[model samples]
Target: MATERMAFDDLPPAVLAGVESHAGEIVKAEMVSQGFNSEIAARVFTANGAFFVKGLRADHKRVWTQRREAEVNPFLRGIAPALRWQTEDAGWVLLGFEALNGHHADYSPGSPDLPKVADVLSRLGEVGCPDIELRHMEQRLERYAAKPSDLAHFAGNSLVHTDLNNENVMVDGPAYLVDWAWASRGAAWLDAAYWVVWLMAAGGHDPQSAERWAGRIPAWQTAAPEAVTAFALATVNVWEEIAGEDPDPWTAGIRDASRRWAEHRKAA
Candidate 1:
């Protein structure tokens, strides 16, 4: 059975027309609703094979995010598939690419891939990110700190996929990190710690196992345990403040864990 094209009723008509011009025949469309960002999909059947159409927001911040991904993806081609084409016509930034096959790393408890996922994340940390000035971690931290939020006096600059939940990681072939909107320079340990928090919330938290996995990544190995803990705690605090009315269970657990980890860090 042929899949039906998904439609976003709210999308501007001009944007839809642009998509139709590029896509030719829209066979299927599905709204990707996993993260905080907004995204839409339209699968079209062409002569070669099915092409995936991604309609993304092209605001100043989001445009910078796309530019960063485009900048780094070429270098990390072997690590994961990179964006193919980026076109903006009629207020819509349309991205077309060959879709990858795999599932996000939402591993169940005791799943063999848990440690492997950690190893992949560690490898990802090693990829070189060119210097860019669009999203400044220090600036974001300072601004957020000034507000009456729990995250104050917490800052570091390491390449981080700011939203490193299980849904953003794939488990097939070489593990691939998806969703590049939030990727930015931040503390490296925070990425791994964020994963730990995410896994725990999903009922897969295992410190002993996580520690062993961390051992595999040399970058993670050199990191100060205290720093990693601090990053983890700070990450949670920031998320909690951003969450506002829509509280995420995963982030809530991370906030609680950060508090505990902070106390332990002080004792040591």
Candidate 2:
């Protein structure tokens, strides 16, 4: 179950004022019940237009994430909603974006959204890594690498949205990626690899089927098979450690799914 969402009316006065300034006189502020990253995730309405505002307390441990999203937004064109305004005031950090009227993409098997998701991945794979300081994909996966040199396969210039969970995708006509706090610079097929583990966890496909779905993305097709296998195994280790620290059905499910993928890779 999701935690309670923060409503526009419930915002602290200073935060509310800042949000209104970036948006307009609030007509309605409907909280989005999905997604867990932001303390506030809502569509702020005004006579002028609706803008999505998501934020957290300035003192929050993840406050730096606000900067990451703001930094990456300009280079994300089409892949993410446009950032309109950002404010830091009254112990809070807030960002306003073009409100999107879309629901999360269904990665479940046979969902028509799969094609669009694949298309977005292929398109994003083509974008050169932005000239910014970001965590390198290889470094991020080092703990899970079977061999130190296996990390080398992950080096590339493509910008990657490291988390491709279903909640991070919104689709109206085209899919829009969101919650970019974990964005990184990595191999072109990196995001596709992330998506495969989630697809398996969602019961959308077996490992073979999931890889086939990912293959629709050009980068995934060309990625070295050994690297793909290493990633699958690395995901198993990553999720296993996460579940051990905070065991929950969601984390456990991903760990299990990743294990299945790793087993399939071994047999292949």
Candidate 3:
């Protein structure tokens, strides 16, 4: 379930004071409209500098996501914004991150951001999975796979940012992946596969074109033909379930794109 967003002024006094203690008095705050997970998502200006702050009550069902983000931050150096500080006070867990000055990545066909994003994914494939609690890809996709044995293809030690929504990618001169909430230990090629669907859905790329882009990452090329087909079929089931649960345009688009990709993979 999505949390109702709150503005800075609505925060408890203790939480505000904690933020102030670390970053100085909050001179102004601009709530970010993107993303659905955080209850408090804003760019806060303080005497020290501007920082992006997001928080959820300590006892919230999804509070574990906060810890996951914090735990994974250290391993995402250069790929994501640095986590400057974290605080748990007034029944809330808050994370302050270095504010980034960039726009959401443009995934449309012919956009220059495509190459930049592919480059970042290539670099990310090199980062070893840190020794921390993380969801494993095989387990996550097990129920959706055609057969239990197919799950084996999704297992690996590479750290992957599974959610490749264009909005989660920030682009300036270089592309940066954000939202570590769904970081997982998965095959190095899986992230590239995930991006292929987003490319078709958001970039208007056909499956052939999208696969061409995925081919840019060496890890992607390492994926076995059967493994890629299994992933595509499993993704169709995953997106259909998501769209069924949340009937929204975005979910529907992705569901349709997943179907298209699955069909393409089957024909090949």
Candidate 4:
């Protein structure tokens, strides 16, 4: 479905109204899927500056997801983009922010930015998370395991930008992480580990660097290796279920990494 075309007109009325409310005049709008979430980017000219109004679909999980993200965004501003505003009356979560000036990170071979990406990931680790009980790898794994075909692998909780692919990251002055719908507490290594597989799947063939990146995660160093591997495998399995037959390269990469980690777990 990656290549399938979706029209903006088909969007829910609530989504359109929410965008219109934020944006006095909608100059342009586009349907973009950043991971599992379907978002609409609406351009508007405001008094301060031109802003991109983002609207997330009101699904079964949107309410709690938005609330959790909104709660934590203040702490994550320097580490990631801020969540501007969210409204429930319109059945849409609205976020307005200054449009990013840089292009998405390309994870192909010979890309000059792998280390930079690693640096960003490392920096992300330093931002402390509150002891809030959000979703974790173990619970997600159980959900996927129960209905394996319906979902993919599950990785239980740590603070994770679960959808950290190239597009989700933009390098303006500094690398900015966007898209928080799937953001949850999971295994600390799972985010970097998942990104490593995503980068490789996008033609980034730096397994050694990927391993190094994974090693840098504090959770991996502190947590039992077996627990970490189980979480990683569960995460991969959840993706595999979501990805189905035509899995993205990133999904495939995660699957491979999960297997290797699983083997290591057995060995340990």
The TM-score leader among the candidates is: 3
Report lDDT (CA) for all predictions.
Answer: 0.58, 0.87, 0.92, 0.59
lDDT of 1 at 29: 56
Tens-digit per-residue lDDT, 131-206, candidate 2: 8878998999999988898899888889999888998999979999988988898999999999999899988599
lDDT of 1 at 177: 76
Better TM-score candidate (2, 3): 3
**TM-score, candidate number 3:** 0.98
Question: RMSD of each candidate?
Answer: 5.5, 1.8, 1.1, 5.2
> Candidate 3 lDDT (Cα, whole model)?
0.92
Count residue pairs with overlapping backbones in model 4. Answer: 22
Arrange candidates, best TM-score first. Answer: 3, 2, 1, 4
Better of 2 and 4 by lDDT: 2
What TM-score against the true fold does each predicted structure earn? 0.75, 0.95, 0.98, 0.71
Q: Residues 151-264, candidate 3, lDDT per residue (tens digit)?
A: 999999999999999999998678989888889998999999999999999947999999999999989988999999999999999988788866788788999999999999
Per-residue alpha-carbon lDDT of candidate 1 for residues 166-210, written as tens digits (9 for 90 to 100): 777777766777666666665555566556556555654455444
Instruction: Give candidate 4 regions above 4 Å deviation.
Output: 1-35, 57-63, 131-133, 143-158, 204-206, 216-220, 245-268
Quote model 1's TM-score.
Answer: 0.75
lDDT score, candidate 3, position 49:
97
